[model samples]
Target: GSTMSQSEAAMAKANPMYNSIYSQLPQYFGEQPWTAGPVYVGAFVMFLFILGCFIVKGPLKWALLGATIFSILLSWGKNFMGLTDLFIDYVPMYNKFRAVSSILVIAEFTIPLLAIFALKEILSKPDTLKLKENRGGAIATLVLTAGVALILAVAPGIFFSGFITTQEMAALKQGLPAEHLAPLVANLTEMRKAIIASDAWRSFFIIVIGCVLLFLYQQRKLKASFTLAGIALLCLIDMWSINKRYLNDEQFVPKSKQTEAFVKTQADEMILQDTTLNYRVLNFIGFPGNTFNENNTAYWHKSVGGYHAAKLRRYQEMIDHHIMPEMQETYQAVATAGGQMDSVDASKFRVLNMLNTKYFIFPAGEQGQAVPVVNPYAYGNAWFVDKVQYVNNANEEIDALNDILPTETAVVDVKFKEQLKGVTEGYKDSLSTIQLTSYEPNRLVYKTFTPKDGVVVFSEIYYPGWRATIDGQPVDIARADYILRAINVPAGEHTIEMWFDPQSIQVTESIAYAALALLLIGVMVLAWTQRNKIAKKS
Candidate 1:
């Protein structure tokens, strides 16, 4: 939950259009507040390769060196002491991404490539100049690795204090009691110190063993093949052992369990029985907490919430402005009543119902069971609105939702009002009705009847791809109620269809098919031309 909130906050702040509070927290900007063991082990390997640059010379060597330095600087994040701030401020799109440590993937690749080049140089047939120079470089690298390791082993605290700021520690305190905070902090500090000391000694030994093998190969005391095999074995063992500390066989589940991971629960089965298929489910059991973003509900039902790294900005804004606040209010009410609320307050869930959430799931008294409650006030798939209230901006449009009857009225942003050409204002047709006849991920069809021209609002997210047609004639789809689809419907019975057919997708697909056909034709021509040459050779 902390990670998700921090990531969301970072994303919101990075995008200037969003109305979110900018956080200055370290974790929000990809700074590690605690020790990461695997990173330390990986760093040791990278250091050895950095040293190898002294002997590994070529055009590829220079390219690798540049990549390695850039990757290292990015991976250092805010820890480089203000260097990363320059990139965040001046570099295009740098501030948009988090987890700066992941940039080390470049270093990971270059380090291994350099390591192989250095090993080849050391094992190759001795030429006096090259062999003498490489051996000295190898010795210097070994000394540096050993010296750093010895210092860490002797006084780990000298480099890292294992102390985190109060604000940093507060991020981890969610859902934890006050009494346990002090003990947890103390234990964390001790654990980090121990990891640093142990990994330091482990890295030292691996480097020393690698140096020994290279020294033997250089001296001609060991066969090249044998020396190479020994060094390879040493690297494999060193990396594997260190990695096993964090991940191992026990971490993997059985194939059968993996397959059954999203199998329908009792509550899910009950909810699926509705058969309406046009509504969404809100699973309160795992909501507003650590597992809130899990997609278990989405596996079988249209869910109001699901997890994704890059969610639609408009949808996220809707969640922030409407959904979360309402949910929090309901939770507080339940808490005040000593956690014995009989049912979710339907009045408090107006925003959720507007999003077409028709079912709510909560943990039952029995351990493995859950209760699914139907929302009585949920609006159907599509509805005819009596009035179109225009708001000047996004903030006003969202705020207007609080007082508007979502089923009876639609709130349209003034910026988008220009897109509504034939849409009529103050148009109320009480006799008009609309029902969703068919639904697919990319297409939706609705049957409607209107005594007079009226606007129809669909509880579907408005995105660029969707195109709406009324009886085969295309019409503009408007962004209604901040994040839903709305279209103007003429009087009389008509078929309204919406299809997600993006021009960009169609163009890219056509290009891909054409490229494939050209490649095939080229291959055939080459084979035919080569046939005569083969016949002559024969």
Candidate 2:
């Protein structure tokens, strides 16, 4: 959840203990301690400029210093001496965001500002004394930056020593084939070392070039524009080269390719042929990123697994407790059977069926084609439960799901007992039917016929703004099956419509329309008044 209260306590508890500056500083500062390259190479180039600003005394310098210091402190994250913790505890809204390291954006901004200010000051008044000071500062900055680069370039092993832990190495070996493990590990270590050493030399060369250009300008041998341009060019080339290494032209694909990226596979094509798109699809291929809710599957179908940063708490809880565990169990079973469980498992179809997953997509047997397995047990959009088990708390509600048939039984928390006072449970009538007649992202309509008054749980995530009406009369939607919506239906035929009607959204829309109307009226009045004034002047 994006809200602070959801994950703040857990994040605070997970803060790493900072032992000493030398030991922990590298973790927070740059990409890697051995490499001169940082996560943001542009920021690193500006950092050298910031160091040079120290010799040029001004109010701007002090301001930049203060901002940079604050940024650095925040960027230290859990590595610093409890400063981040103090902020999260006492500062309002500070704990709302998780990545404290992102605060270094301020430092990145301040460094360039200070650097530009220093350059302007030096160029504006090129007195011998000021030039000498500038020369001294430039030399000092170059020496410090270059000396570290030199050491890294000469002997990277002295500082880094292939910092992979024994446990990490073992894990790497375990993942690889026995015959290839040793050679791969050795090659990977050498590659990492080479990258660091190479980047160090690259940084050293750029810094030295910048220093020489500044020195030439100080000596009055080069024009101000030329010197500045030369230094800027060096910084641009250095940062661009480093950046290209990560995000190159190859990363981008044509629009057609991007559209084709989500092309319907053989399994997807099979699912699409169903015509009844009431149910969701569960892709066993898993999410592209670490997150369960990524939009990869959602690009084509209403996926049970879709990405959202501030996903509904109950939905996340459902995934954590029910979906993920079942998937993991399937994976473990395959692994135990001496089969490489790389892609999908058909055995975990039970959980998918409960989520109303109509089609399950999995990797075809070594063919690279997707195979869609139709779930026979999938409950339709809505169903009448045979019984409702009232639970005291969330834990019990989740636990009750393990034994109950999801299509014929629902677990409702005791907190909702009052809402269900008029609603009857255990009223099973096989003749009753609920079919999804119309659907939209924000609205759903169901044509339902009930043999008797009963509760019908809908396979939709229970969220705040969803409102339900049976035959245009408002009905209470209860949280059923831990994360789905359930509403009581009368014995007769009724139009059950659920729509997202958030008051906040309505209010925001009204305000926007009103503001636009006012602006248009004001513009018309002003134009009329100006016309009369122009006539009088004429």
Estimate, for each residue in 1-538, the C-alpha lDDT of model 2 and write its tens digit. 0111122222232223211211222211123223322346353355355554656586867878888888898877767858988888999988766456667778878877777776666666655325554567655665677877889888866776454556546665676568765664454455445555766777777767776666678789999899778868877887787576556788699999978877666677777778784788877664333327456668877888777756777777778788877756654554464444334444454455667877656655666456676655577788888877788899998887777777777788878776666343656676888889998889999998887888888888887788989999998888888888888777878899999999889999999999999999999999999999999999
Candidate 1 Cα errors over 4 Å, as ranges: 1-45, 72-103, 123-140, 163-168, 171-181, 242-248, 251-255, 331-347, 364-369, 386-405, 408-415, 422-426
Best by lDDT: 1
Span of 10 residues, lowest total lDDT, candidate 2? 1-10
Model 1 clashing residue pairs (backbone): none
lDDT measured at residue 46 in model 1 versus the true structure, 0 to 100: 53
Best candidate per TM-score, number? 1
Alpha carbon deviation, residue 136, candidate 2 (Å): 7.7
Alpha-carbon local distance difference test for all models = 0.72, 0.69
- How good is model 1 by TM-score? 0.77
Where does model 2 exceed 4 Å of error?
1-44, 56-103, 127-140, 161-171, 177-179, 285-300, 305-317, 328-350, 362-369, 386-405, 408-432, 449-454, 474-482, 488-492, 501-538
